[model samples]
Target: MIDTRLSDPKLNDEQGRVLALQRYQILDTPREAPFDRIAGLVKAVMQVPIAIISLIDSERQWFKSCIGMGDTTETTREVSFCTHTIQAREPLYIPDARLDPRFATNPLVTGAPFIRSYVGVPLCTPDGYNVGSLCAIDTIPREYTPSQIEVLKSFAALAAEELELRRVAQIDFVTGAATRRGFTVEVDKAIARYGRYARSSALLVLDLDHFKKVNDTWGHAAGDAVLRAVGAKLNALLRATDVLGRLGGEEFGILLAEATLRDASRSAERFRKAIEAIEIENDPPIKVTASFGISAIGPEHATADQWLAEADLALYAAKRGGRNRSCIAPSSAETQLSRPA
Candidate 1:
């Protein structure tokens, strides 16, 4: 029988856990040496054929590092032992897979890999969310000592620290939003997820209207204050799953996860109004407006650059159609304009 705690929404904070995991922006990214070395160390120290650093995504278990699983980067959550591992505070130890009813029919156990024994420690964030697991696997049934479990826990701590460090490094200083590199990484992951799941998502590229004049008239310090205010306002309006980033200068980007073009249009309109309402405290208060360009992720978008280019085009359209408006790609009929009345 499956553990109700793992499967039931009321018993666990799955949405929060997934959001915490996404905040690290590690999903679908290339393998890093730190995580790879950790997996290698786990394999060597535990004398196991397979060792993995797994991040439990909403629908799948994605491996940041995997040894002994040749070319396999991910698997569905249903067949993943790491899924169960993430649910508990203590290490999950299955000494014999064949004997455990949960594993008797699991594809990983009965088919390839043929895992007979497994031990996994939850990779818990500093705030207490279990995002994934660190595991050591052997082909034959075996019992792991308490000392060994402690070693695994130590490694898991290191992994969690790496994630926290990355999250800190990804933030833009002035705006308190993601930096260009960090935002681009998230766009890449969003593209990969769209390819795999066909889920609808959209990107909005925004540039503040006449931003250079703000710096020219009020000095750079005032400009920075305006940028910070706009960033905070946008952050307050966005959902937990949505990503906001300072792409450079007065330009920003927002990744609206699981939203359609229509949804993005409405959101962009809201953001435009919010930015217009922002007042920066200076010798004289400064109010600003932003022009928005939105592009829904589609099959035509093969890369982040492509997706961004489409939105950028729409942004240009918004600029031409007059500022403080939102435009959607591929058609003028979809453009949403909020001119001064």
Candidate 2:
């Protein structure tokens, strides 16, 4: 029931810290095994029932890896001891919550988990923002040894490293789309769901029309600008459930969950129109269009590669039937005829 207004004095550069934290995009995401393992190991080492990898959001402390919390995923920032640790930007050790004036009145201290002792190390980002903490909590108060503190610090650093590495691996460097590998992994899972539930899904494989001409005439820099713009446009067209990735040079792939072939065609048309509308105010004002090949998940396709090949065949048909259009493949084993859009 305490207000945290101006209470956490050590929350340095609040705006920058928030921006850095958002860059990780770890909040509310499914618990990852790496983070869970860290929390589990910390719990084992500290012999505590409660251990978590917590991210301090604007209004709450959200656990990315929670163990022994009994379905409690988050707590309000006002009562969060992890929030205090993040503000301090260092390990916070409170042997007895009742003995500490700061936490004695906290609801978590008086209420659930009845937190009696806590030792938390700040998970600092590379740019010096303390985003959250890797913490161990005990219902009964106890002191931590100096060796225990060192081990906890190492674990916190390990969690930070993993978060950063995963962030890099998830995104495409140039277009900010999912990387090819990331997209492939996601598609595998999506296909598995489609197989189990027989859900309708669509794949679109697209390539820029006359992309090499842009690279040759306007140079690679201009080509990169076109690619970046197109990538952004395609991303905007996607739903939250859909995933698009830069498959490779001048090519991108989209996986539309629960979408039919017609839905896929409609989406592809939108992408083509969007790219065609991009008038780069260059010396000559570069304009571009893209060709799309759409394929629905059917009995013929079981793997990501097979689905992509189906889309590629349709895309080639789009290029052949004149560029700047979408072509959809029939549900047959081979792409015999492509329906142009």
Q: What is the lDDT of candidate 1?
A: 0.90
TM-score of 1: 0.83
Ten contiguous residues with the weakest lDDT in model 1:
332-341
Question: All predictions: root-mean-square deviation over Cα?
Answer: 4.7, 8.0
For every model shown, the clashing-pair count is 0, 0
In TM-score terms, candidate 2 sits at 0.62
Which stretches of candidate 2 lie above 4 Å from their native place? 2-161, 332-341
Q: Estimate each model's TM-score.
A: 0.83, 0.62
Tens digits of lDDT, candidate 2, 172-230: 87787888887877677668777788887888899999899999999989988988888
